[model samples]
Each structure stands twice: as structure tokens, then as C-alpha cells.
Target chain A: MQQVFGNKKAIAVFVLPTLILFIVVGFLPIVQSVYYSLLEWDGFGKGKFVGFALYQDLFVNDTYGIKFLNSVWNTFYLAILSVCVQLPFAFFLAHVLARGIKGEKFYRTFFFIPVTISSAVIGLLFLSVLNPNYGVLNIVLDQLGLGSWKHDWLTEDKTALSSIFLPAVWQWVGYYMLLMYAAIKGISEDLFEAAKIDGASGWRMTFSIVIPLIAPIIKVCVIFAVIGSLKFFDLTFIMTNGAPQPATDVPSTLMYNAIFRRNMYGYGSVMAVFMVLECLLVYFALQRLFRSREEEVAR
Target chain B: MISALRTKWSNVVLQFFLIAFAVVQLYPLVWLVLTSFKTNLEITGSNVIGLPSKWMFENYKYVWVGSDLARNFANSLWYTAITVVASGLLASMVSYAVTRMKWKLSKLVLLIIMSGLMIPVHATLLPLFIILRDVHLLNTPWALIVPYTVNAIPTAMFILVGFFSALPRELEEASVVDGCSIYQVFFRIMLPLVKPALVSISIFTFLSAWNELMFANTFINKSSLMTITVAINSLRGLHTTEYGPIAAGMVIATLPTILMYIFLSDKVQKSIVAGAIKG
Candidate 1:
């Protein structure tokens, strides 16, 4: 059995193909992007080495820097809102649903529908809903005697970025809810029974029991939300394409414009490198944050 | 008796809250479907959110024929189908080897594959674009299929590894004792046992490939090669006033997944829960 299982050729056949593909597509590009970020290439001509010059531009050059920072802020804003706003709402929904309400399964399943559909479809759907003239939103606002509230949601800079976030947040509320819901559901019922027998109410049980128990999952959810926001592109790309350019841009839309649209391969690669490092940084930071806290709880 | 009455009243309130939020979650989709069949005039005029006076089934006809939507739909289907198969096969092989095989480097290999999940898709776009271009895969089906399959592999491996790890060692040992070759053991014995994992992984791989837009938009410039998401986005730009057909396009793009979910919600839900727990 050990001989068969350890057959070198069989192991090679099984692992080599996947390993090669993963490295070429999944792993190599990241290394390539880091190398490319240091060059000044238009993706056609010979690349000139300019170590950290583009990075300087990304950080301080007025035109590019301002736009890059704004996009970063926009993404971070979404991250903040996702963690602060969306997760809580999802947790509330999860908490209520986990309490075994009527139609609990139905609600759990239905809420996740937005997540399954493509962001492009959701973006287009919201575009129609937020269209200033014929949009359902403005029309509804008019009917509600709030006509003054109507603005060009996709066009106006003040409203554009936030408008994009609505659909972005809306789509994933169910997702994080489901994650937390599953975690909450996994808690042994005996604990809940004991708490109830001690005369704890639902809210008290949630705070003292559910919240503490599912804290790790909630932390995971936060990392997901933040990382998701950091990389979010499809909806913003679909809805605005950074219409109020620089205002509505996220790092991804900017990276896209730099590479595909403008042929600034080097510049774009810098943005790409920045994003990858940023994601890694945040991921490690969060893991460290969560791990320390878990140790504290254990202590 | 009074406390029981209060509990009943609170349960009603909770039910009401859940129902209300459900409407919020589902109404936009329902509205999109309704708007799909409505005349553009009605959509922009007297019936923004109500039933259309004239249900224009022709809208579907227009989007399907007047553009490359049918071709795009075919491309999306072709890409998604190939991706699902390729990722599932590759992932299963990797999972089986890492879990069952007694190899020294299996741990390192699994770690390498799993780390693929951490790199955001956009982070790799520039280099991937260059790589594809250099290989002359740009504007071809391989451009999207290769990337989509590669992207899905890590998650597919993550899911399949658990299933593969849980299987008893005796099954493989018995198969080997019966004179089955390693390939035979994997193909005949191991593959059939993990069919449920394959199904869940396929559902996930299918959804990502089907809904993918950035790569589809960037890589494929030829109208014939574009996928449904790009086609729908283009329709919105080209036929701005023709809301009916655009809505129809959105519906067509969305219908497969919605219908799929309705049929396989249990598997879909489990797959998602499983995927998220990996983090």
C-alpha cells in the first residue's frame, strides 16, 4: 500500500500539472507585477528601469497621487462601512434568523440571491434604478414628497461613490450574514439552554453568549469585508467607470485604466503591486489582531 | 399566560422584520424581471415600478438578434462549462495526491496552491494580460478559460481536500490489494466517492466564470468572443434609450444562475458556507 501510494511517477502525474498551472497563472503574475512596477514601459517598447520613481508618483505626484489617494480613500470608506454598517445589519439578521424564526430558511436563502448574480447585472440593475429621470428611486422619492432629495446618483460626484457602495454593500449583506449565521448556528444548543434557564433574555444571551462565541467568525467576516472592499471593482467599473473620474475610482479601476486603457503598463503594475502588498499587509495584520485577542480570551 | 402572549407578539415582530428585509433584498430582482417585459416608454413614463400595460416580449427578441448577445451567451456557456470541468479535474488530482499520497513535498505544494487565494484577481491582471498577449491567447476563448480555471483551482482544492481527507484509507488499500493500479484506484474508487464535493465545487466554479466581467471585457475585443456580462454592459452603452432590451439582456444574463439556485439552493448554500469557512 505504501509502495503504491508513494509511486513517484503517479505522484508526479497527479501534482505536476496543477502545480505548473498554479505557478504560471496563479503565482507568477504577482512576481512579474513586482518586477514590472519598477520599469517605465508602455508594454510595447523596451522597459527602462526606474526603481521607485513610479512609486513616488503614486504617493506624491499631484495629478496621479491625488487620484490614487482618493481611490484608496473611496475603497477604505467602503471597507469601513462594510465592517461598521453592513456586518451589523447582517449579524442582526443572522441573530434573528438563527433564533429559528418563521421562514428562517427562506430568508437565509433569498437574501443570498444578490450575491449569486454577477456584479455587472447588479450594477446595471442599480443604474436603471438610480437613473435621474426615469429611475425608480427618483420617481419613488417624488411620490413620497421628497423630490428635493433626487439627484443624478451616478453622475454627481458627491453622490456617485456612495451610490456605488449601496449596491456593493447590498449584494454581500446576505453573504456575511450566512457566514455568521452558520457560525452562530454551530454553537452547542446546550449552552443556550443553560443561559435561558438562568433567566437570560434573547438580547442578553446574544451579547453574553452569541457575540462572544462567534467573535472569531465576526473577525473573519471583518477581514473578508475589508479585503473584499480593497479589491472591489466590478460594480464600480460597471456603474461609474469612475465617471466623476478620480472621485469614484477604486485602486482596481485606476489600475485597469492605467494598464488596459492608457497602456501605462509600468504605472499600472505599480498600482497592482501596491494592491497585492496592501492586501497581504491587511490580511496579516488582521490575523495578528484576531490571534492576540483570541489568546487574551483564552487566558 | 401573559408572558406567553408577550413572547408570541415578539415573534410576530421578528417575523415582520425578516419579511420586510426579505422584500428589500428581493424586490430589485423582481422589478428587473418586470421591467424586462415592459415597453421602454412605460418604463420611463407612467409605469416606473408597476406592471407594464404592454408586455413587450419583443425586447428579448431584439437583444438576442439585434446584437451579439446570443453569441456572447454561447461564449459564456462555453467558457463556464470548460472552466468547471478543468478546475474540478485539476483540483481533484491535486487534492487526492496531497491528501492520500505519501509524498515529502505534498505539504509545501498544498500550501503553495492554497496561497493562491490570498492574491486578489486585479493584482495579477496586468501581468496576466501581458502573459496572455505574449502567448497569442488574447481575443481567444483560451484567454478567459485559462484564467478562470486557474482562479477557481485554489478554492476547488480547498473544498475537495476536506472530502478527500475524510475517506477511509482501507478503501484505497483494498483496491490496491485487488491489483488495481494507482490510476485505477483514483479513477474507479476515489473519484466516485467524492462526487458530492465535485458537485459543490462545480457550482462555485460555474458561478465565478459565468459572472466574470473584467477579464472578459479586457481580454476579448472581438464581438463574437465576448461573454454575456460584457455584452450586457455594451448594450447599456450602445442602446441607451432602449431600456427594455437592456433590461431583457440583464434578465437573460441573470436567469441561468437564478434558475440554478432555485433548483440547487441546498448545494449552493452549502458550497458557499464551505467556501467562506476557509478564511
Candidate 2:
């Protein structure tokens, strides 16, 4: 069996092409990014080794540092809202839908619709929906006799950040809901029956029974939400291009402008490196935090 | 009786909330489709949320004829097709080798490949630009296809490996004993067994490659080679306030995905779950 299954030529034929492609296209660029992050150069021509000055500018220079840090903060803000606001709402929906209501599948089918559509389309959809003069939002506000509530959603600094992010956050609520719904559904009916017999209400079952049972999956969702927030680009680019630069800019958009627009390749690579590290750091830190909590629960 | 009444009332509220939330999730696509049919005047004036007074079929005609969107749509279809097929085939081969075939470095190779999931694709953009430029592949469709297919490998393998690992060893062994070669057993037997996994992963790969924007935008400078997302963006650039035509282009770009979901919601949902599991 080993001889037949492990034909050397066959294994090479099966694996080598994918391995080489992954290395060249997927892995090599990451290594090159790390190398470029250490230099000071435009995208074209020769690059000079600058020994982390580019990275220092991201942290210490007034113009670059301020914008970069603000971008980082905005990205973190997204993660915070996704966990605090979006996930909880998804949980609520998943909890209600898990109770075997009529049209449960019907509701779920619609809820997941936005997830299938492109972020570009979603961005454009929200762009028009928030188009100030003719937008549905302002028109509705007017109909409700609250004309003062209307503002240029994507143009104003105050609303632009939150407004652009609303669609991004909204797109994935169904996703996390579906994940948590599946996790909650995996809980045995006997446990729920026991809770109900003890006179525990639906809210009580949710807090005491469902939350604890699905804690691991919830932790995974939180991590996913955070890392995904750190990588957000398309919608931000489409809606505003991080206009009012440091105000609404997230990391990817900032990096895009730095490298692609301004030819600041080295500084841009610093942002890129920072993003990759940020994702990894958050992922491991969350794992450690979740693991420790699990241990505490065991005790 | 009073407790039962409380339960029934709460259920009604819950149902109402679910319906409202579903409408919120679904309303924008509804709006986009409706906005596509309206004239610019109707869209901007009296009918932001109602049926168009004059349904303008010209918007679709404009997108289909007036711009390079038709050519761009063809490019998108061609690129997405190749990506789906290539990623599917390559992922299956790798998954089979690692899970079924005995190899010394299989585990290590799988680890390196799966790690690609964590490395955000955007981080590689600068370096990829340099690499592709040096190789003279910057403006070609291969620029997007190569990276898209490669980026997809990790998620595809993550799905396929589980299915491949679950097949009983004796099934393959029996085929081997019948004098079938390893290649034949893999291609003729094992591959067929994992067709369901292949279908789900292919759907996911198709959706992602179709909707990809940044790489398509940055790598392919020529408008002729641009995908629908880039084309639509350029269209938006050229016609800033022509919401009717822009909306029509968006509708055309999103129609395939929406239609596919209507037909295969279960498969789409399952594939999304499979993709998210990698996270």
C-alpha cells in the first residue's frame, strides 16, 4: 500500500506545481515586502537601504506618523464595533432564528444575500443611498420631519468614517449569525429542555446555557472580525478613498495611497508589514486570552 | 394561560424583528435593481424608493453598448473561469497527495501552503507589482489569474483535505489491488468521490475571482483587460453623476451572483461556512 500510494514521481507530479506556484505568487512577495520595508525608495529605480527610517517615519514623523496612527486607530475602531455592535446583533438574530420559527430558512436566505454581492457593488450601493440630495436616507429623514438630520454622509469627516463602515459592518452580520447559529444548533435539545423545566426563560437560557456552550465558536468569530477589520480596503477605497486623509483613512487605503499614488514604496511597505504583524499579533493574543479563560472555566 | 400568552407575544416580537432585519439585509440589492431601471431624473427626484415612472431600458443598453463594459464583462468571465478551474484542479491534486499518498514532507508542505491564508493579500501588492513588472507579466490577464489562483489554494485545500482524508483507505487499496495505477485510482475513483467538495469550493473560488477589484485595478492598466469591477469603477469615474448607467453596470456585475444564490442558496451558504472556517 505504501509503495503504491507513495510513488515518488506521482507525488511530485501532484504537488510540485502547486508548491511552486504558491511559493512564487503567494509566499515570495511576502518575503520581498519585508525586505522592501527596510529601504527608502520609490517604486521604480534603485532602492537604498535606510535601516528602518521609513518605519520610524510611520511612528515619529509629524505628517506621516499622524496619518498612519490615525489610520491604525480607525481600523481598531472597526474591530471594536464589529465585536461590540455587529456580533451581538448577529447573535440576537441567530438566537431567535434557532428557536425553530416559521420562515427561518426564508429569513436566513435573505440575510446572507449581501455576503454574496461584491464589496464594490455594496460600496456603490451605499454611495448612492447616502447621496445627500437624492439619497433615500435624506429623503426618508425629510419625510419623517427631521430634515436637519440629513448630512453628506460620505463627504463629512464626522459621518464619513462611520457611514462608510456601516455597510462593511452590515455585510457580515449574517455571516457571523450563520456561524453562531450553527454552533448554537449543535447544542443538545436535552440541555435546553432541562433549562426550560427549571423555569429558565429564553433570555436565561441564552446567557447561562447557549453562551457558555458556544464560547469557543464566539471567540473564533471575534478573532475573525478583528483580523478582517484590519484588512478592510475595497469599500473604503470606493466610497471615499479615505478622503479627509487621516480622518477616515484605514491602514490599507493609507498604504495604497502611499505606495501606489505617492510613490512612497518603502513607507507603504512599512504599513504593509505593520498590517501583517498586527493581524498575527491580534490572532495569537486572542488565542492566548481565550485559552486562559478556558482554563479558568475548567477550574 | 397567562404564561402561554407571554410566550406567544414574545414569539410575535421575535418574528417581527427577524422580518425587519431580513428586509434591511435585502433592501439595497432591491434598490440597486430598481434604480437601474429609472431615468436619472426619476432616480434623483420623485422616485428614490418607488417604482420608476418611466422605466428606462436604455441604461442597460448603455452599459452593454456605450462603454467597454461588454468587453470588460467578457474578460471577467474568462478570468473567473480559468481561475476556478485551475484552483480547483490544483487544490484537489495537492489535497490528494497530502492526505492519501504517503510522502515524507507532505505535512510540512501543507503547513507552508495553509499559512498563506493568514498573509493578507494586500500586503503583497507592492512586491507583487515589482515581481510582475520584472517578469513582464504586469499588463496581462495572467497577472490577476496567477495571484488569484495561488491565493485561493489555501482555502481550497482547507476544504478538500477534510473530504480526502475521510475516504476509507481500503477503497483506494482495493483499486490498487485490481492492477489500477495510482494515477488512475486518483483520477478515476477518488476524484469522483469528492465531487461535492469540488463543487462547493469552485462556487466560492468563482465568487471571489469575479468580485476581485484591487489586483485587477492595479495590475492591469489597460482598460481593455479590466474586469467588471474595474470597468464599473472607471465608468463611475467618467460619469460621476450618471447614477442610472452606473447603477445598471453594478446590476449587471452582481446579477450572476444573485441568480446563483437564488438557485443554490444551500451550496452557497455551505461554501461560505467552509471559507470562514479557515479564519
Candidate 3:
């Protein structure tokens, strides 16, 4: 039985299809993206090799006036908000719900409904609600005597990017909440019982016991939020399509426009490559940051 | 007495907060449903938040029958179905091999597959587009199918591996000692034991494939081959200010998953949590 199961051929047969597909569809494309980033081509014609000029143009030149750096900044801006605002809100909800609140199941399901729905649908839902002319938001604001605060949420450059962040944060707070809630639920009840017997205040108990124990899951949620923000495309694409002079452009949308719209495959590939590297760098930095803090806590 | 009063007050406040937050979370969807039933005049009226004075069901009929939504719906259904089954089976096999089978390179193989999770789909668009064009699958459902299955493998495997690793070894050993072949042991004995994980992975994959927009938008240009997402996106482009049919289109696109979540919320939540912690 061991011999048959351990046969080299059997192992290859089982594992190779997925591995090959992963390489072909996942790994090779990334390597090819890097290679393509180094060339000048229209994606169909014969390419001429230009060394790192595209990367420099991405940073320095405004030849296309696409604001590559602005898109990068926008992506990071969303990532920061995700980490700061979304994570805390999610964590707070999870922390509260983990106390075995009544109708916890109902609340959990209700909150996560948005997560299951497609981003495109959510984008449309919000677009209708935020439309400048007939949007419910501006109408409500007028009734509440806050009409001065209303503007073209998706059109005007001042509010377009910030407007998108609301839906972005809305869609996923419940998702991260569920993650942290699950982690918190896994904590042993005995610790809470002991803390109660010791007369620990509820706030103190949560701050010290619950928060510390769920720190690892919190890190996971942070990484998810950061990466999710970096790759945020669907909502922005469907909602605004990077309109009003690229005000709400993220890297993924920028990459899409470059390749598909402008036929600048090399420039698009550079954005893709940059996204991959940024994700890796942020992931490792997060790991190191969390690991060092864990060590400090242990000491 | 003061402490007890404080507890009661806090509980009321907390409940209010939770309920309020839930309202904020769900109001947009409720508004969407209501607006879908309203006339364009009603939607564009000064009273944007009011119930439709007359619920018009024609918007739904227009969206369902007037457009290519029905065909696109079929495309989304079949694409998601194929992706879920193929990816689930492949991922389960690889997971079983990596977790149970004693192979020297199992860890490396697992690493290679799992690393696919980090590569954003956008990064692969250009080359994928070119490859599909070369293979004459640019407008075919296969373009979406192949990438969907490939990209879904990591998350599916991540869930399956945890389940596979936790399965008791005695059952496999007993089956083997009874002259059952390795294939029989796997197919007949092992696969059923991990049904829960497989179900969760299928749900996750189905939701993702159903919601997939970028690939569908990029690869499939013809209205005949467009998924519901891409189809609805086109609908948006054509009917930019036509709120009723547009809202109806979104409801059509979103209803299946929303209903699925309603029934299988537990399994979905468990899968998400398990995938997060384990992956």
C-alpha cells in the first residue's frame, strides 16, 4: 500500500496538472509581464527591446498624462484607510459580537450579505444612490439642511476618489468582522470565566485578553485589507471607470486602461509588475512587524 | 444597583449601535429593490427615497427579455459550474497528495500552488489575452473557464488541505490492507470524508466565478458570450440614465448569490474563516 501510494508516477499524476496550470496561468504570466515591461510594442507588432525606459517613463514622464504616480498614491491611500478605518470598525464589531450578543447569527448573515454580492452589483447599487442629479444621498442631505455638503460624488475630482472609498470600506468590513469573530470565538471560555472572577472590567478584559489572543488573525485581516485595496479594480471600474481625469484610478484600473485602451502593453505590464513587487514587499514587512511585536510580547 | 443600571444602559446602547450599523449596511440594497420597481419619473423625482407609488414590473421584463441578460445568465451559470467542479476536483487531488501521500517534493509542490494566491489577476491580463487569442479562445467561455479554475486552485486547496490533514489515517490503512488499490482508496474511501470542505470550496468558487468581471469583460467581446457581469456592464453603458432597468439588471445579476448566502450562510462563513486562518 505504501509503495503504491508513494510511487513517483502517482504523485506526479496527482500534483502535476495543478502545478502546470499554476505555472502557466499564474507564474509564467508574471514573468512574461516583467519581460514585456522591458520592451516597446503595441502587443501585436514586432517588439523592440527598451531597457527600463518604460519604468522611468512610468515615474518621471507625463507623456500620456495618465498620472501613474497619482494612481499609485491613490492605491496606497486606500490601503491606509483600509488598515486604519476598516480594520478597526471590523474589529470593533467582531469584538462586540463575540460576546454572544443576541441574534448573532442574524447579524452575521446580514452583514456578510454584501460580501457575497459581486462588486459590480455593489458599484451599481451605490452609483444609483450617489448620482448627483437624482441620488438619494443629495436628496436626503437637502432635507437634513446639509445640502451644501453634496456634490457630484463620482464626477467631480474633489470627491470622486473619496466617494469610492465609502463603498470599498462598506463591502468588506463585514468580511473582516467575520474573520476576527471566528478567531475570537475560538478563544477558550475558561479564560473569560477566570477574568470575570478576578473582577476584570469588560473593557480591560477585551483590551488585554481578547485583543492579544486575536492578534494573529488581526494581522491576517490587515494583509487582506491592504492587498485587497491595492488590487481594487472592479468597483472603481464599474462605478466611475476612472473618469473625471483619472481621479479615482487605482493601479489595476490603470493597468487595464494602459493595455486594453491605449494598447501600451509594456507600460501596463510595468504597473502589473510593480503591483506584484509591492504586494510582496508589504507582505514581508507586515510579517516582520508582527513577528517582532510577538517576540516583544513574549519577552 | 448603580452597576446593574449601567449594564442595562450599556446593553441598550450596544444593541442600538448594532442595529443602526446593520441598517446602514443593508439600506442601499433595500433602496435598490424599491427603485427597481419604480418608474423613471419616480426615480428622478425630488422624493428619491419614497416607495414607488405604482410598482412597475416592466423594468424586470425589459431587462430579462429585452436584453441579452438571459443568455449571459446561462453563460455565467455554465462557466461557474465548470470552474467549481474542475477546480474543486483538481485541488482536492493535489491537496490529498500533498497532505496524505508521502512524497519528498510534496511540500515544494504545495508551496508552488499556494503562491498562486498572491498573483493579482490584473497582472496576468495581457499575456492571457494574447495566449487566448493565439489559441482562438479569445471570445470563448474557455478563456474564463481555464483562468477561473487555475486561479481558484489555491484557495480551494487551502481549504481542502486542512480537512485532508485532519482525516484519521486508520481508515486509509484499513482500506489498503483489504486489497483496495490506491485509486480506490482515494476515490471510494477518502473523497467522501472531506465532503464538507469540498462543499465549502465549491460555494466559494461558484461565488467568485459568478462575480468575475475583469476576465469576462476583457476576454469575451461578443454579447453572445458575455457573462452576467459583462452583460450588465454593457447594459449600464447603454442605459446610463435609465435607472429602472439598470437596477433590475443588477438585481438579476445579484439574486442567485444572495439567495445562496441566505440558505448556506453557515457553510459560507465557516469556509471564509477556515480559508483565512489556514491559508
Sorted on DockQ, best first, the list reads 1, 2, 3
Looking at candidate 3, what is the lDDT of residue B68? 91
Off by over 4 Å in 3: none
| lDDT (Cα, tens digit) per residue for candidate 3, span B1-279 | 999999889888989999999999999999989988988888888447988888889999999998899999999999999999999999988999999999888999898888887878888999999888988989998999999999899999888898899999999999889988878888899999999989888988998899988999999999988999888888977787778998899898998998888888899898778778752
Candidate 2 chain A least-lDDT 10 residues: A60-69
TM-scores for chain A over all candidates: 0.97, 0.96, 0.97
Task: Give a tens-digit lDDT track for model 2, residues A36-106.
Answer: 99988987688999988887778887455446788889989999999999999999888878878889899
> Any runs in candidate 1 off by more than 4 Å, and if so which?
A63-66
Query: What is residue B267's positional error in candidate 1, in angstroms?
Result: 1.0
Model 1 agreement with the true structure over B177-205: per-residue lDDT tens digits: 99999999999999999999999999988
**How big is the positional error of residue A182 in model 1, measured in Å on the Cα after superposition?**
1.6
- What's model 3's overall lDDT? 0.89
Least accurate 10 contiguous residues by lDDT in model 3 chain B = B270-279
Q: Model 3, A1-299: lDDT tens per residue? A: 67967967777888888888888888899889999999988888877899899998888886778898888889889999999999999989998888888878888889888899898888888887888988889988988999999998989999999888889899899999999999999999999999999999889999889999999999899888888888889988988878886798888998998899998999899999999998889888988999999999999
Between candidates 1 and 3, the one scoring higher on DockQ is 1
RMSD, every candidate, angstroms? 1.2, 1.3, 1.3
Residue B211 miss distance in model 3 (angstroms): 0.9
